[model samples]
Target: MAMSRNEILDQVKEVLVDALGLDEDEVTEGATLMGDLGAESIDFLDIVFRLEKTFGIKVPREELFPAESLMNNPDFVSGGKLTPKGLAEFKARMPHSDFSKFEANPDINKLTDLFTVAAVVNFVERKLNQAA
Candidate 1:
């Protein structure tokens, strides 16, 4: 079965905490990985890699770094400063699907978790399959 949004978020947080050596309590749904977690550009990439590994998702570069969108988000100030509200807003803006049922015609909000997990898993599976 696929995971819920909350479940994915929790797992993301856990992977972040472990990879970044941060306190679990500090990594909340409203915490910005770059702002609150002091993640530099390279660190951010590391986080992304960890996220992909943990969640089995392959986040697109455009989704990861949308220059225009990032500039508009409140969490990112002139110098990439993130506030708690910004983090919350960022999380709220993430693409989410229900991941409960498989469907040919999916409602925007009713997408199965497999879709989300597949982003990462497919990448790994493809690579591994090719290797074999």
Candidate 2:
């Protein structure tokens, strides 16, 4: 059976709390990842790695760090800042055609509650598949 939205969110929160060393209560859906979570670029990459390990997904380097044009999108954001809600919304909006097949698939439509763990895992898994 597929995981429930709450289940995914809870897992995402747990991953963030453990990986980023933040208190569980601090990681709300609207919290800013960089501003609130104190995650630098390297830390973000580490989170990506942890996600991949947890969910067996791969994300592309280009996708992970897209060009400025792609960066301009609200979904992509400025200053490496991402709100948990925004991240969830972006995942929900991604089309199947936008990503390569073979990575671990999570319920992006339910992503508003999905959080970063599943998304990061899906991204890293996609990258790994591309490299294979």
Best by TM-score: 2
Cα lDDT tens digits for candidate 1, 53-115:
775566554454433364465444324443445434433444332223423322222211222
Q: For model 1, give the 10-residue run with minimal summed lDDT.
A: 106-115
Instruction: Judge candidate 1 at residue 110 and give its lDDT.
Output: 24
- For residue 86, model 2's alpha carbon misses the true position, in angstroms, by 17
Candidate 2 Cα outliers beyond 4 Å, as residue runs: 61-132
Question: Candidate 2 on 28-132: residue-level lDDT in tens?
Answer: 755545655777667767766765666555644345433323335665453454444444444444421133221233333322222234443344444444545
- 1 in model 1: Cα distance from truth in Å? 1.4
On the 0 to 100 scale, the lDDT of residue 52 in model 1 is: 69
Question: What's every prediction's RMSD, in angstroms?
Answer: 12.0, 10.6
At residue 116, give the lDDT of candidate 1.
37
